[model samples]
Target: MDSLFDVLETNNKAMMSIAITRKGQPLYSRAIGYSWYGPVKTQANTKTKYRIGSISKVFTAVMIFQLIEEGKLQLTTPLSKYYPTVPNAARITIAQMLNHSSGIHSFTADSGYTSWLTQKVTPATLLSKMMPAEFEPGTQHKYSNSNFVLLGYIIEKLEKKPYAATLKNRITGKIGLKDTYYGGKIVAANNEAYSYNWQGNWAPDTETDMSIPGGAGALVSTPADLDKFMEALFAGKLVSRASLTQMKTVEKGFGMNLFVFPFKGHTAYGHDGGIDGFRSQAAYFPADSIAIAYTANGVNTNLNNILIGVLSIVFNTPYTVPDFKTTLYKTEELDKYLGVYASTQIPLKITITKKDVVLVAQATGQSAFDLDAVAKHQFKFDPAGIEMVFDPINSQMTLKQAGREFLFTKEK
Candidate 1:
């Protein structure tokens, strides 16, 4: 798709790599953009591995399902069975953890986690710092990286092996993913893509120390290796058909460490990962027998739109990227809508400023989104596929995106 490349190039994307396969046969592959930015200017290649953020959750989930099939563990097993030191562990079940319904507060959401990570805290010590359950176990669905961290711990305890070794022996090794590994001090040669944030400059990729965020987000892999891993996983090379079915089933938005995107009349299953500077997505459409793996070294590029564009080509669907057209407005027109808007359900606050729009969601710090005018009273997030419709009649605005909607009321 030349048009796809044009869009990316026009945006000056720092790095973009993609691998596409159908029924285990490679159909298309490409890599573009500099892996490192400087006077040296090293170009990225197919072999350049990337820190795949939360996509590592899918691998951890597969390993756990394999253990379940081997009778070494059960999904209903209580957390206390393995780690009694955790508060209220007796009341939390493995199934709850898998679906992120455990109600345990995410260590990553803790304000001090970043500081602790910088100091390189051990896994046990990280767990010890977590507070009690945010709510009773299984009360509702909430994503927490700590759940998967504990899952990694359980895998290590039950298998009597290091998490990395077990992952290699069971998943990566069995599937022959030559370039995939749990990242550590010794990164592979020609191995990983250095990551960059959108600070108007490029920098090296950063991640939480493996000892702290291990199972949740601690894997490095190439796009080719990711495609291979998904192929083997769905081919029953890693687990039984019944176990595979369970893993793909949507228990919640989060299940077995994977997020299910049941959208556009097809069930596309995968996970999207974001660390400090790397973002990755690996998705498979079982009905179409299509799998796509995309990894980028730059943050804030909104790779989701690119994936949707590629999916349109693959699925023959009509897809159009929303045009973020800006309309000239007098300062007086902007003042009427400038106020704080709040939503109780998600507990989000939106603050409109003269230059940009910002959202503060529960447990997520404030993130600024550039707003573009589409109509007299409507704005769209150019980077995030979100639309904000202002209803002056009711003095409210609705945030619509990704098949979900939330209403916000202006503060008096």
Candidate 2:
């Protein structure tokens, strides 16, 4: 396991940390890259904290179940009991929200999300941003940060304490996760890494306000602590076995706050999170009594690729490290790729742009993402499994994603 990371650091400059355990015993642990890349660089280590994004939902779900065990709430509890003014609140249940069947439109998906990402939002203001339900309650499974955000508020309401206070009193303190808590501004002095994308350098990524994400995606933790949380939660130190079982109940690819991952015919239950450029994943395999966690603060490659590589190394399967090579282009060379592209089969128009030498692509009304060059006129965003081959002569592009290809023409 250690040799794989050694190879990755030698070839790839991406910054990340890892923790692996078996039956609650540490098997391996490692950290690489800088938590703060400033005048004096702060190297990230096992104790460096990162915003674990939606993994915070797992914590929120556990607290909700704790309330349920105490007879304070139920799976069928109506959102109307707490916030009746929310759209369709009267019809949504706690279970529906837990399993992402509430149809609550994710506020983060709104066009204006990036506009105010770094600013603190009041509860009422944030509530108004949740657009109307996308479907009837329990009709579909769609992950929505709004669901867990509301659930977080509901937890505070029931506990009669602030979310942070309740978190300490209930979860982190119990598990001895001193590094995990509701997040704030990225404080490098505190060993919290500022997230970054690979743009010529490790360019800082946008930071969302902690107040807005609530229980949905606002918690800072280290990889080691994350592994501990998973171990303790599964060992019945956090919630009752019945509650844990309920939380693990899978429906339509989502559990209460958990997601299912299958590896080599073995089932692993865990969650992944992303906010800013930071990405994290934590998984627990009951069958093998194993738990693994990784927190990435800088990424130049596909996050999925890293997960697969790490898992392969852990399972002792044959593995190969990426060369992390890319062709560099002058700022002027990207001009031909700049245009609005449209496909006959899809409604969204893709706009290609460039900053300095970094190629970028953005779909209609969506945030722009940097694209890395693989070859001449060829680019890919591996995180989304997206690749685009461009024809500067024909004014066309072939977009491929999820194994489907579509030809697009540059719009006049």
Candidate 3:
């Protein structure tokens, strides 16, 4: 078994903390890198807290289950029963919110939401800004921060207490997560990790008003505390067996609070969290009695890739980091597939270039992924998880990944 600190020192430059356990016994708990990168050097430890970001959704979901146990709410209950002010509140249900089937526009999509996050705003005001529905309620799955924000409001309406107070009373306090908090007006005085963003070459500390994120991404917690929370959640400390089943039930791509990931004949349940400058992932394998939690203070780096790497190292599984080495292709080879290929129903565009493959994804922004050939006609961009399959017979191409594929036609 490799020391967690040794792995961190070798793989990551940003501050990182990891905790792993099996059958309720702690196997690894360690931290690496500086707590703050500055003139005054500060090192991190097991107690150092990082912004857990959307992992807060798991906490929010647990609270909803608590309310369900108390007979105050039902999964099938329509949102209009609580907030009649919402435009299509009657059409959306509590379960839809949990499973992210609600078509409400994610507050993160709002152009002005960023500015509002810098200044504190009440939950009601934030909800008010999201009055119009992006799509019909419960029509399809679309991850939205507004769903959790409304959930926070629903908790307050039913409990007759503030969201933060209710969270501490029902979830954090009961689970013995001392370091976790909703993190706006109330924050831990010590051992809190400052969030940083890379501006040019230097890191700058950044903060988001917790009130704005609410149940979506406001919680701050440590790796050990998160492990405890997951244990309690699955061990039936938080909800009954039936309620836990509902939480884990896969509706579309999301379960209750956690997203389901299918890997190598095993089911892994966990949530990944991300804010402006922080990224985190926590996963638990029930049958194997194994759990993994990773946290980093940088955004651009895909912690999922790091998680895969750590899992491979810990379990001694055969895993290779995707090859990111770019290969230069002749202009003639690029011209074979170079054209404006698009899907009318889905928003996707692909352009092949001599130097790179350009993907203009309307939803995820635009980026150029360097193509590396695995074979004469088969090429892929490892980092982007995209593959271009060419048809020699017809001279066409197919772009595939993430369960969605688009075909590109040659243009004259």
Candidate 4:
């Protein structure tokens, strides 16, 4: 597993924790980097808790299923029963919400979400942001945070308690999870790790109000605790076998709050999560009785590469850790790309800027992201597989990714 360790060592993550278990036994477990980035950086241990982001939805799905098992909820129940104002509430079913087929407009996808992320959002304000359904209910599959948020509200109403309490009593508490709970403001004394985005230096990211992501992405946990939770959940300790199978069943490429992940000669059920600077992925392969969980506080490297490395090690497949070290460009080299580029075919515009010495890119409606220099005049955003090559002579830029290329003329 030295290759797995090498990947962590080479990446610019502030902290990462990973655990792999087979048949209830740990095959590999490790934590690397610091809990935070600073001269006073606290080394991350296996117990350090990072926000698990949307992984909380899996636990939320379990609660909904538990309610279903008790005859308190029905998969076919319409949203009108609880939330009348929601668009198409009379037609959208609980199962539609569970599988992201409800067509409810995701509030996070709105252009103005970043402006309100830091402020506390009341339930009424949150509802107001729902806008309208994107399409006819149950017609097509489109993932939306609004669906999970509504499910959480339903859980709260039915349980006669807050969503956090329901989560604790119904899932975490039942699974004996010691380090999993709803997160709030970052409390350093509590050993909660704040997330960061890496460029040349680790830049701290803003924390979203927990209320904004509640029941959808508010839970904080260590990888070990998450691995334990998934094991118990799949072993029929959290939900019934019937409900578990339903959660695993996919429709239009989406299951009930779960996604299908196929690995070497085996299929696994899992979810990937991202909120703020933290990202996570966890999966369980029943065929092999193996479970793997990874959490990161800062990610400058592509997460897929890390997961592929870990899984390859678990399956005894040959894998190589990537060499991430790259050549540094001087200030003069960066200044040449600092300008606005516009494409006639697309309404979006790309603006590149240099902060100190780090190159950053911002498009219409999106926040700026640091772009790493992969080669002279060629920079890339690894997370999105976006590569930008600049032609100073023609004053043009070529953007390539996903087997397509677009050319943009540099604007004076």
Candidate 5:
């Protein structure tokens, strides 16, 4: 139990909150780190709210199923019934959108997405920006943000109200989730956590407009509220048992806004989400009658590793606390790894740079990330499970990841 706290302190997340329950009884609940960074920092607590990101998809799915239960919607309904001009509208069904098999282009992955992601967007404007479908409807599985966005729009249309209002009346209000709601600008007074990208110091991350994520990634919630929601959802307080079964039915590795996570021969159904610097996970294991939720405002370590640690704690399994201390490297020593390195094995190039005595690595068409040095000429990016060993004398580097190695030579 102490080891779990040790892991949180060592990982140094800006804010980390976890809540776990079994048989409808809470087993553990904890929160650590600061909700706000810098001189005017505010410590996080069990009640602090964090943007849950794509976990909102799960909530959106719940609302859709509720509508179906009320005879207001049908899973087999075609998209043309709502928006005929949408690509593949004639062929795509509501179920395809729910399971992310709609073949619609993911607007979040579009080339210009980042350019305007921070700005507010109207529904029509956002839909107009969506690219044509990439594949025939239901022919293949493809996770797309556009699908959830469209679903959100449908929820709004059918409810004759805004998405946030529908969520309040149909879900959160019914669950009595005091700490969950639609997010807006971070207001320190309300205990909303500010997301950050961690390096040697916390760097404030850019805020994505809530309107852009909409039902895809806009909801804010605490771990406790998330756990409660999962419990009620599985207990049939939200949707009918038959409808819940459909949401859990897997097709091409995806269910209706739910995904299965295997742990020690047991499967948990839930979703993971990331938006800016916030990372979230919520899952419920019906066999064990357990529900767990974790939310973080900032992370430098791998998120999966964190989730594994929380699960291990809940299950009373053996787990080791990570050693967060880093070996300091001189500025001159870090400069040696600075260069553009390319690998013949893959059509990608990595440019390493020295930033304030720390090594940073950036790949082609990707954002730069700080690489922590473990030893002389050896640096690692833990988030991606990647390690790089630089041989400055030969102007070459070897990258090791998941038991595979790639060799790169510095270009002249």
Candidate 6:
């Protein structure tokens, strides 16, 4: 797969560690980039670990089902049994939270999330952030990390142990996922990869405090371990087939934490994870008995673009690799677009500024992100699927993302 770099239009500009499995056996594995970037770079390998982020929700869901099997809980159990103070807690069921229909506001999606991302949080802190239910429980579906965080707490309450210990005693130990566990501060000496985002070079990304993510995210693993977890979970070694079916159930693209991943005529069930600058994925195709897992500590372009390229080759389908071409504009050339811009369609305001040769953009209370210049007056932040076309003459910027467009007029 060395040629994958060529097709990826990479000149060591991307980082990846991937493993493929079929019929519960390893089929392929590859690692690229450094585990620790410094004076003496430490090259990453298959054993190198990464924070799997929200993929930990799949593990959380599996444990929740296991508790149900043991008669310790039920899908219809009211969340108020554990946290009665939460708004509409009595009306929210375990199943609703599992399927993301609980209406619990996502704490991480809050505008102030970035400010405290690196600090530990208390139950009271997280509880305070759980805004009033956006809708009646089970009336609609919306993705919320608050749901999983509460579920994680419930797991601790039922199992009489911390989430990490329960994870080991229940799943990883039974399944032999040696490299998977609750994570702490990253230690390069332990082969934990530090994540980065590229501007003109790889800039170290801030590490979100582990305590804050809780069961919604906080787990470190390798691609191989993730592949193993998916294989075992799908093979009924982790949960019963009935429970697996429950996890695979979806509405509006989210399922208990499992998501619908459609490529061609094949449907794969799995989850994608991201934290700080790290990104990871694990997808299983039951029909083909194939499991694919990948982790990236650094990516210079749209990661889905990279994943599709890898999948097309694996699935034996013809694929077209895009040409990676961009024109560089001097920092001074971007001065015309620097200002606070507000949109009529969205509540948030976007501020644009340039650092060195990179054009950076920040939204309302969100973190600032660097945008790459793809063409004159056109820029993109591929990581977030955001593109901007600046009409400097009109003092306006058209923002496009996920097939939606909004016109933003710069503040005078």
**Candidate 2 deviation (Cα RMSD):** 2.9
lDDT of 5 at 340: 99
Model 6, TM vs. native: 0.87
Candidate 5 lDDT over residue span 1-412, tens digit each: 5565656566673367888899889998888888899888888899899999999999999999999999999999999999888898989999999998889888999887888988988988888866678899989999998999999999999999999999999999998988888888888799899898877777798889988999899999999999999999999999999989999999989999899999887789999989989999999999999999989988777778778877877777888877655679878878778999999999999999987778999999998888888877888888788899999999999999888999999998
Model 3 lDDT per residue over 1-412, tens place: 3443454355343467888887778988777765566687577788888888898888899899889989989989999898877768888899999988878768778876666666778767876777678778778888888889889888888989888899889888887889888775323347667666533223755678787778888888888888888888889998898988888888777888787765666666889887767778777887777777767664323345556666776677887654334445566656665555554546666665554332222222565544556666777654346678877467567777766777765444
Taken over the whole model, the C-alpha lDDT of each candidate is 0.76, 0.89, 0.72, 0.86, 0.89, 0.88
RMSD over all Cα atoms, model 6: 3.1
**Candidate 2 clashing pairs, residues 3+ apart or interchain:** none
What is the Å distance of residue 170 in model 3 from its true position? 1.6
What is candidate 4's TM-score against the reference? 0.91
lDDT of 6 by residue, 1-412 (tens): 5577554425445777999888878888888887777688888899999998889899999999999999999999999999998889999999999999999999999878999999988988899999877899988998888998999999999988899999999989988999999999899988999998776677788899998888899999998989889988998998899999989988776788799899999989999999998999999999998899998888877889778888898898997766556678877898999999998899979999888888899998787888878888999887778999999999999999999999999999
Best of the candidates, TM-score: 5
Report the C-alpha displacement of residue 198, candidate 6, in angstroms. 2.0
For model 5, give the RMSD to the true fold. 1.8
Better candidate by lDDT, 1 or 6:
6
Cα error, candidate 5, residue 310 (Å): 1.7
lDDT of 4 by residue, 191-277 (tens): 788888775677788899999988788899988888888899899999999999999999989999778999778788988888999
Compared to the true structure, candidate 3 yields what TM-score?
0.77
Question: Per-residue lDDT tens digits of candidate 2, residues 1-412?
Answer: 6665665566445788999999888888999888877677788888889999989999999999999999999999999999988889989999999999998889999977889989999989988988688999998899899999999999999999999999999999988999999998888879888988765567778988899999999999988899999999999999999999989999988899888989887889999999989999999999888899999888766778778888887787778877556679999999999999999999879999999998999999887888878899999887678899999999999999888999999998
Stretches of candidate 6 above 4 Å error?
6-13, 328-379, 386-400, 404-412
Q: Summing lDDT over every window of 10 consecutive residues in candidate 3, give the lowest-scoring window.
A: 355-364
Per-residue lDDT tens digits for candidate 1, residues 1-412, read 5567556655554376789999989878877766776678777777788888889888999989988988999999999898777777888998888888887779889876666664577776767776677888888889988888899889999899999999999988888988888876524346456677654356555655666678888898877788888777777888888887777767646656656765578777788887767788888777878788988887444566777788887777897753334576766677667778887768778876654332222213566655656678887664466778888677788889888999988888
- Give the residue spans of candidate 1 off by over 4 A: 185-189, 203-205, 320-381, 386-412
